[model samples]
Target: MAKESSHAVHAAGAHRVVVIVDENSNPFELGCATEIFGLRRPETGRDLYDFRLCSPEPRTLMRDGFFTLTGVAGLEAADAADTLIVPNRPDTDVPRRPAVLDAVRRAHARGARLVGFCSGAFTLAEAGVLDGRRATAHWQWADSFRARFPSVHLESDVLFVDDGDILTAAGSTAALDLGLHMVRRDYGAEIANSVSRRLVFAAHRDGGQRQFVERPMPDLPDESLAPVLAWAQERLDSPLTVSDLAARAAVSPATLHRRFRAQLGTTPLTWLTGERLALACRLIERGESRFEVVARRSGIGTAANLRTLMRRETGISPSAYKARFGPQTNG
Candidate 1:
């Protein structure tokens, strides 16, 4: 069994993110990592992370032999990573290389934050790092993962799980969700929003969302949450409710709930709250020091409500948030 980690990651400098590529690794997930962590952000005018790709071998073949990736860093790169993404491949049954597992163990022993995407949970489990930690993997592999690693708490329904030092994404697309979430944790909500806009993806999706919906396909081409979401986003400062969102979508509240579940894998109220909270954070980031002002402007109702919600969501008070993200004033 792996030891529990209370100590933070033994990393320094510009937070480095390293992805370990193994044979038969899925390219989509690798792309998601690079897009979120490695891409140069001309919009932000600064590289957010020191992202690197490493492999146990010099030449690594991707999932289904789609392409060969060569000439990146070696597995030793994982040691220097503040956050290390363990190798994930489609072939869950095939055992991970001993060297790869050793690297994972070494990283974990040193308190490096470890991430597992899709079937990568299996790798982390095999390395004995996720023994008692909660994690999520592709729903299809939930039973297998649980059966193989009985001690690990596997939350199959969730899109991902962020158990402090260890994180895991449920499926291929969920990788992006988890990646954006990581950016939010590292850089804050504002930068995460910028990255999401660049990808043209939804800015925030709660990790508790279902991994897969039974009827994921839209019933009609025109049936979309975009218009209603847009309407609600513009009116976040208003006393907006789920019913209001339903009316804007021209659907019954029940139908709205179904659509929200089908499309976003979240409830109407949850989405509304998230949007409002995001607005509140942005207001604070832009130097809204008074909690009362931020609360009213962001439609969060009151300063006390803002404090409770902010603490619940971000684990910090409005003053603390302002101190971290707000404009620095020299005394």
Candidate 2:
């Protein structure tokens, strides 16, 4: 039979979590679900998610000729789920099965929260769940996704898009961020922090995937920009300029601008803005005593400047960012 069935064990009123895994699915995405919902965490004293792995077809799902997954629940399980998670699709261009699309539409109609990671946004888009809604996918597929789903508001610059019940994350690692955000939303910030500590990842990364994209590696033997970057990082509290950086690197200002454009895909000023924003985020996450101090340390100079830059980059004020990631103190 194409539809094999199973039930998710809803633990005495826990939300039912259904994750749809297809052939050639990457294990990292599956691991994200397992780590966030599958693992038993009695220490947190909160309601846990009852996770179910379902498939549209009955045959075993294989990855890399090893690690075969069997006994996947059927599409019917998705109808009963409180949350439906769609990991990256096998291929973004391939059309989703009609049965799968129908199931997804039904689940969303029933008020189930829909989540898509990376290329899986294609599935949601096909099901019309993301129509007229803001969404994101891996940067590499952003152009294709927008072209295919023209009705959806595609945001390629963000790490994730949380449109109430429908959430979509970008790339592989960004899925983890989305999962943690879900945990924080359902449980609380404390539980999310604990999970992050257990995983040994930063509680939150400020900005978006734009900060991590690969650029042409710099190509100077003796006058590399690494030393200049390191020096600038150490003196973020001081007002620094591109001319100062050029002088430090012992290169002319025009040469420095060319090197930044060629190697970083951005101008020196743009990169400096990102670096300053990154610093402010770190200080906020570390529980800085004052926003002014953080602003000074990040070279933003004033609290208003910090707010403007942070809002421009993350769509949130510095105080809100701090509240979400700052240290917790018990009274």
Candidate 3:
């Protein structure tokens, strides 16, 4: 608890959300906040967030050479917000203004959640909010972040890390995942899924940043594993093993392992598990009611197994997840 008195709470029905913007703020990160929380969505019957784009001073904020945003709120707006979002800051080397840092500290102290996307994580770290807290940012900046804030427990491999109140996400599109997660937390998985579907994106992503990273091309150009992967994806309900995959790929088990390590940066089994989890999550989002059915379709085969796996990956039971993501028919 830091300073609870300064933050603003939404009126009984509205969700007060604020995004801090500055000169040279990346429009995409700011847009991620606005698009998810600020956009007007009437179909879901969810109370929209009372969104504000704020700055430390009253002035025009220029970005991307052509777009100029003016008449924005001041730092005090962030201090008063129920949720404060810090989008990407232009320069990590620039010292955070004392006023901005104060606002962040006060908001978090009062139990308001704080979020930083991409370089915004640096700002949270500068404010001392991320000290001893596990967080992440763009992998490219991982070294500098560690050097600048040695006390922070930075994990760069994951797309995002949700540690209850304060959360941080990696670079770029990962912000979408982080924002969707916030929606899932605040409202439920149902709202999050609806929002994602509106955006025409997957409700849940597989693996983490590790999957997106570019690696040196493998020495062998093996189109062999592609067919096996496609086949396995079609029959997720069927139990599959490395030997089965290897046989389908027409490669020795050792070769399959090496190929997977070289091309996917993970073992075939791990990749399969991630795919199954993704499938289960999608089914949950689509309003599937039966845990056993979801388990079977996702290849977990049993509700018990599905619950164990979902808990391990998301820290929530399948029923709880469905409650969050399923249709809001009753309401």
Candidate 4:
């Protein structure tokens, strides 16, 4: 999935964000939509989004009988939105209301950006918006998702997939990550960081962090790859090659490659680079100002190499990154 460019900032007040709520929806996912987009942020010094909630049945929608949501707008509201977010459904197999599916399809047909939180991807898939496009959902539903929608590229690993106009988050918790990503694309890093500070979370988590949630942590002690992964993480500053990783795991490079792909859905090198980048972010957040120092400490080797890698991975320069997430910003 292609990320929307951060360099092209949209004008303030131009974006309309609509949340589609229904029976059996997850309230936490709905709250994620509202908290990220509905709330007004004066700190941004510009309007972020005109946000509202809509329902196929406008009066009230009960989420699993745990609570009730009232005062939601009707389906017509989606037609006016620049973006439409579909939160998780109670059961992936249960078909959505015909009107609900129609609203989603119409919104997409009219050029509105579509987003699915967790099992909400099932809704989009049922509506035919996700056909032949890369998407994701709650990891628990991966097999059923593939069985039902074979045409959709189900990337079970990763927090979210940003397939340009249509985006799908892996799980409900990852919804915030995807939302902040949208904010960054619409406004810029500085504004997105401000929002993250308010929320007490990182401004961004690379989408590549997606992994199979079921076995994210190794269960078997002796036979587990966790020890080997921990060993490599502790020594990212060293020139650790595939052979080195294989040796640490006491397996051949070929076996290690298969294990990494089977367990993590990513190559060993890609995972290592993500870890190194994460370390680089921490150094930047800690007020590390020297690019050379940051590079050596993060194990990217040199300042020039760090700059190139950081930009390619994050779509922002290191200095600009520091400006938003550095320790000074915390104060």
RMSD to the true structure for each prediction, in A, is 2.9, 7.5, 4.6, 6.0
Score every model by TM-score: 0.92, 0.63, 0.78, 0.68
lDDT by residue for model 3 (222-328), tens? 64456788899898889998889998888888988877766665678887887788688778877888989999999988999999998887667888777655665
In candidate 4, which residue ranges exceed 4 Å CA deviation?
A: 1-12, 211-331
List where candidate 3 sits over 4 angstroms from the true fold: 1-14, 42-48, 63-66, 184-194, 200-202, 215-233, 242-268, 278-290, 322-330
Alpha-carbon local distance difference test for all models: 0.86, 0.74, 0.77, 0.80
**Cα misplacement distance, residue 277 of candidate 3 (Å):** 3.3
Per-candidate clashes come to: 0, 0, 7, 1
Candidate 3 overall lDDT versus native: 0.77
Q: Which has the better TM-score: candidate 1, or candidate 3? A: 1
Which prediction has more favorable lDDT, 1 or 2?
1
**Which regions of candidate 2 fall more than 4 Å away from where they truly are?**
1-12, 63-66, 206-211, 214-331
Candidate 1 to truth, TM: 0.92
Q: In candidate 2, what are the lDDT values of residues 124-195, reduced to their tens digit?
A: 999988888888888788889888889999888767887777888886777888888777555445566778
Q: Which should have the higher lDDT, number 2 or number 4?
A: 4
Q: Estimate, for each residue in 259-292, the C-alpha lDDT of model 1 and write its tens digit.
A: 8889888899998998899999888877778889
Write out the backbone clash pairs for model 1.
none
